[model samples]
Target: MESNYHTLKRNYNQLIVITHLTQLLTYITGFGGLVVPLIIWATQKDRVEEMDAHGKSILNFQLSILIYSIISIPLILVFGLGIITLILIAILAFVMPIVNAIKASNGELPSYPLSLNFVS
Candidate 1:
């Protein structure tokens, strides 16, 4: 008999919330904000309800932040505009995960503003 594991769809709001919050790991450990979530999403997307969507949003947001930060580096040489942009990006990166985590806990889809569609 074939195992039914792949056909199972579990409601794991807590895992989804955790996935969203993992974005903060970059702030704490200077890394893993993307890596952790990417791993979780990859491993659980098929098993956990809504994991794929949440994972995609998280990845896109992280990628966008990386791109924005890279562009801002050159702006730093142009009257310190990069500093301001970097600050805003930091704030957005820190805040959006918390907001999306709250939404995930409520069974709502996450919305990351300014994220590019890199995965989907």
Candidate 2:
């Protein structure tokens, strides 16, 4: 019974970590930032409420960042401001999810600044 509980806890933690880190797939698949979490959240949301919350938060952040990146493209022709904006987007995309994953692992609710509630 004790071992079973430990296994369950470990699996729960794994799911939480995966939910946050799967956004890294965006680098490979281009749209994985939203697609991966959407898939995972759809599959696991019923099994784990925490995953649902994490999924919504991640989706909101990803959507917000996507919009910001798109808006920055025009600035590239302006004063090279788009270059800096792109760099910041890349940094935020790479770092914010990891920070949120760490917080999720420790059973804390993670909040992404600049995230808009697209998923509720």
RMSD of each: 4.3, 1.4
Local distance difference test scores for all models = 0.91, 0.88
Model 1 CA lDDT for position 19 = 95
Best by lDDT: 1
In model 2, the worst 10-residue window by lDDT is 44-53
Per-residue lDDT tens digits for candidate 2, residues 35-110, read 9888988888888748878888998999999999999999999878999999999899989999999999888887
lDDT of 2 at 97: 91
For candidate 1, report its TM-score.
0.90
lDDT, residue 101, model 1: 95
* Model 1 ranges with Cα > 4 A deviation: 1-11
State the number of backbone clashes in model 1.
0
Q: Estimate each model's TM-score.
A: 0.90, 0.91
